[model samples]
Target: MDRFARIDTLINNARIFISRPSNRDTEGDVTAVLGVNIAGHITQLAAAHDRGGR
Candidate 1:
């Protein structure tokens, strides 16, 4: 924001994939994956929109 003064485009290419058997997956593990895959994207999108970018 300081250097560019504004945002033109936002690219969200960050993600995490955890492969495990359902029986081995814990609540915390699922929460973490959701937080990164879903919440993370929403947060980025909101930030980009606030910065007047696509």
Candidate 2:
């Protein structure tokens, strides 16, 4: 989303490729992958807000 791009320097595969397939999703896929990905992205927004973003 534009929000993430604005707050984060970039979105890297490293963060997306973390949690293994098993731990990543209930179907041993990407259900949790998306969840984890969103969390990482949110961290950036929160940081920016805490730092006082316009």
RMSD of each: 4.7, 9.2
lDDT per residue as tens, model 1, 1-54: 667765566666768677877779889888887877886676676586676785
RMSD of candidate 2 to the truth, in angstroms, is 9.2
Identify the leading candidate in terms of lDDT.
1
Off by over 4 Å in 2: 1-28
Query: What residue pairs clash in candidate 2, if any at all?
Result: none
lDDT of each: 0.73, 0.57
Q: List the residue pairs that clash in candidate 1.
A: none
Error of 1 at 24 (Å): 1.6
Alpha-carbon TM-score of each model against the true structure: 0.47, 0.41
